[model samples]
Structure formats: C-alpha cells, structure tokens
Target: MIVVNLDVMMAKRKISLTELADRVGLTPANLSIFKTGKARAVRFSTLERICRELDCQPSDLLEYRPDEVPQNV
Candidate 1:
C-alpha cells in the first residue's frame, strides 16, 4: 500500500497547509485531500510542485507499506 507522508514533511519544513497550497498554486481544500491520503490519484505536475515547495524528494512524500491492506480491497 502507498502512504502519503505529506503531513510529516510539512511539519519538518514548518509549513502550513494554507501556505503550501498558495505556494503550489493549489486550493487548500484540494491539497488537504491529498495531505490526508484520501486522494485516489495525483498528477506528476502536482507532485513536482509539492516537492519543489517542500524542498524534498518524491520518496520523502510517498512510502510503500507492503504489510498494509488496501481499504477498498
């Protein structure tokens, strides 16, 4: 399973959702969905913007947990 580590990275960078959203040119609501790991899919462009604003790599934001089961499964 894939896990979104957005909140962790944001906390490390000391950035708020509203602030990050503005910097990444996305609405806070939309970013919130992604941050909460409720997003079914994400665009690479969005990931690039997020990584750029957070000053992190894509691996820092996403993680794989093979032990976890998918909710829908």
Candidate 2:
C-alpha cells in the first residue's frame, strides 16, 4: 500500500495547509484531500509542484508498505 507522508513533511517544514496550497497553486480543499491520503490518484505535475514547494523528494512524500491492505480491497 502507498502512504502519503504529506502531513509529516508539512509539519517538518512548519507550513500550514493554506500556505502550502497557495504556494503550490492548488486549492486548500484539493490539497487537503491529497494530504489526508484520500486521493485515489495524483498527477506528476502536482507532485512536482508539492515537492518543489516542500523542498523534498518524491520518496519523502510517498512510502510503500507491503503489509498494508488497500481500503477498497
């Protein structure tokens, strides 16, 4: 399973959801969905924007846990 570590990075960076959303050119609601790991899919452009604003790598935002099961499954 894939886990989104967006909240962790946001905390580490000490940035608010509103601030990050503005910086990444996304609406707070949309970003929130992604941040909460409720997003079914994400675009590379969106990921690039997030990583750029957060000053982190893609690996830092996403993690794989093989033992976890998908909610829909």
Q: What is the TM-score of each candidate against the true structure?
A: 0.92, 0.93
RMSD each, Å: 1.3, 1.2
Candidate-wise lDDT, in order: 0.93, 0.93
lDDT of 2: 0.93
TM-score of 1: 0.92
List the pairs of residues colliding in candidate 1.
Answer: none
lDDT of 1: 0.93
Residues 1-73, candidate 2: write the lDDT tens digits.
8889999999999999999999999999999988878889999999999999999999999998898886633
Error of 2 at 69 (Å): 1.5
Error of 1 at 17 (Å): 0.2
Worst 10 residues of 2 by lDDT: 64-73
- Measured by TM-score, the strongest candidate is 2
